[model samples]
Target: MLAKANRITSADDYRVIVRRGAKVAGAHTVSYLRSRESGTDARFGFIVSKKVGTAVRRNLVRRRLKAVCHEALGDGVCDVDVVVRALPSASAADWNEIRAEVLNALERRRARASIDAASQKGE
Candidate 1:
């Protein structure tokens, strides 16, 4: 379970992150990551739409995504806001599959941000 402090509760926060955050897309999900400078808790939001499935299926996918986020919560994700949007394929994905996809996307997004920062500093 994700803590309240680690959850993004506002629609505006979701919109801003989804629009401005760096994106990392996987077969089962798309992760949007934006850095902030305040605290160690990385906030997370999920979007499991009708395209993924009915209420039951969508909720299952959302729960699985949340579990992955909870499991992977760590220092690397600090000072960031993440929104995970489930793809249609996610309804059929098992926990391990969803976990791998989400975790890898987070890792890749962080890598991309670091690389961009390094390049900018070198210029």
Candidate 2:
């Protein structure tokens, strides 16, 4: 499990990410992210809805997401708030596929940040 400092704990934070932040899409999941102003560690949250399955299935999906986050963006990502939402397809996705998707999502998030920063600078 992720440490306290590396977890999103508030509904307000999650809502901000979902409503105003940019998204990174994966095959089995989607990540919404917002950059943090002061920190070097990345924080994360996972959301597996009932549409995925029962308690057992949701836990499995959460576990898979945590592993992918650790493997893909573990060290490179900076301080940010991230929420990973699982799709129904996630239940059947293998580790390799999930990892690929997570990486792709991270990359997209980075790119979006760059664009947003550039636009802010222009204004």
Candidate 3:
């Protein structure tokens, strides 16, 4: 799990990121993110609501999400705050399935952002 400073906290922050951030959706989760100040460190947060299931189920979803985020973003992406929301299906999903979905989402998001940025600069 990431530290407090690394997590997106306030409602305002989440809203801002949702409005301006790049997003990638997976089968069991979605990651919304905004670039950070320094562009060298990455922060993360996970959300697993009661709608998912019991406390244990929610925790399991969060745990898997966290692990996937850590592995997917580890030192490769920089200076961003990412918020991951788990869907109900995630509560019972396997780790490898979750991991592949997450990694694919992150990769696709990165590729799209790169393309958009390049086009913006008229490259």
Candidate 4:
């Protein structure tokens, strides 16, 4: 489960992140990541729409995404807000696939951030 502090719950925050965050697309989900102040915890949000499936299936996908975010938090991601929007295919994707894709996207973000940091340092 995600701690309250680690979950994105405000409508405006979601709108901003979804609109302005860097996008990372996967086979089953699209993730938007935005940087926050370094002292803040990493926050996560999910959008599992009807296109994904019935309420039960949508909830299942949301739960899986949440668990993945929780696991990612344990891996030391912080100072970022990530909002994952489940694609229709996500309802059919197994947990392992979803996990792999989401993790890959997050890892890609880390790599990108590092390169950015290096570039800034070099300038």
Candidate 5:
């Protein structure tokens, strides 16, 4: 579980991240990330819809996603707000599969950002 300070708790914050953040999609998950100017640590939110499964299955998927996020982004690697939405396919995925998808998403986000930065610099 993430500490209160590291969790994105407000609906408005989630909306902002979803609307304005850069996104990366993998086979079983999609992640949106928005960098904050002042924050030194990253914060995260997870969304597992009813479409994924029944309450028990949904909760299980949520827990797995949380653990993946905690492992992948909990370190002070970047100051960003991240919202990870699980796809229906996630219901059947294992921990290694979920972790790989999450990491791939983050890496794609980083690559896109660097490309954007380079373009802005006219490089």
Candidate 6:
């Protein structure tokens, strides 16, 4: 489990990230990332819908996602809020597969941010 400080717990917070954040989609997961100016730690939220499976499978997917995010984020302090939503396919995915997908989504988000920054600077 992620530390409380590093977890997004409010519905409003999730809504803000989902509405205003940059998004990256993988085969089994979609990630939304929003950078904040005031926060000191990166926060993460997971969404495993009922469409993914029953209670047991949903919990399993959430746990796996949390582990993946912990490993990927490590102790990085970026003031970013991340929401990772698992698709139906995620229920069948292995840990490595889920990890890879989440990591890839994050990488894609980073790449897009850099490109956007460069373009803004060029303007």
What order do candidates take by lDDT, descending?
Answer: 4, 1, 6, 5, 2, 3
Candidate 3: tens digits of C-alpha lDDT, residues 72-111: 6564865667777788888878899888877776677677
**Runs off by more than 4 Å, candidate 3:** 120-123
The global Cα lDDT (0 to 1) of model 1 is 0.88
- After TM-score superposition, the amount by which residue 62's alpha carbon in candidate 3 deviates from its true location, in angstroms, is 0.6
The residue-by-residue lDDT of candidate 4 on 1-123, one tens digit each, is 899999999999999999999999999999999999878999999999999999999999999999999999999998899999999999999999999988988898889989999999999
Model 6, span 1-123: residue lDDT tens:
788988999999999999999888888998999977654777899999999999999999999999988886673536678999999999999999999987877777667767978999999
Give the number of the best model, judged by TM-score: 4
lDDT of model 2 at position 10: 93
| Selected candidate, larger TM-score, 4 vs 5 | 4
Prediction 3 global C-alpha lDDT: 0.76
Q: TM-score of the candidate numbered 2?
A: 0.84
Q: Write the per-residue lDDT of candidate 5 for residues 1-123, one digit (tens) a residue.
A: 977877999999999999999888888998999987754677889999999999998999999988877887654446678899999999999889988987777777667767978999995
lDDT by residue (tens digit), candidate 2, 2-59:
7777788899888988887778777788888878886667888888999888889889
RMSD of each: 1.9, 2.3, 2.3, 0.8, 2.1, 2.1
Worst 10 residues of 3 by lDDT: 72-81
lDDT for every model?
A: 0.88, 0.81, 0.76, 0.94, 0.85, 0.87
Candidate 1 residue spans exceeding 4 A from truth: 74-76, 116-123
Which should have the higher TM-score, number 2 or number 3?
2
Q: After superposition, how far is residue 116 of candidate 4 from its true place, in Å?
A: 1.1
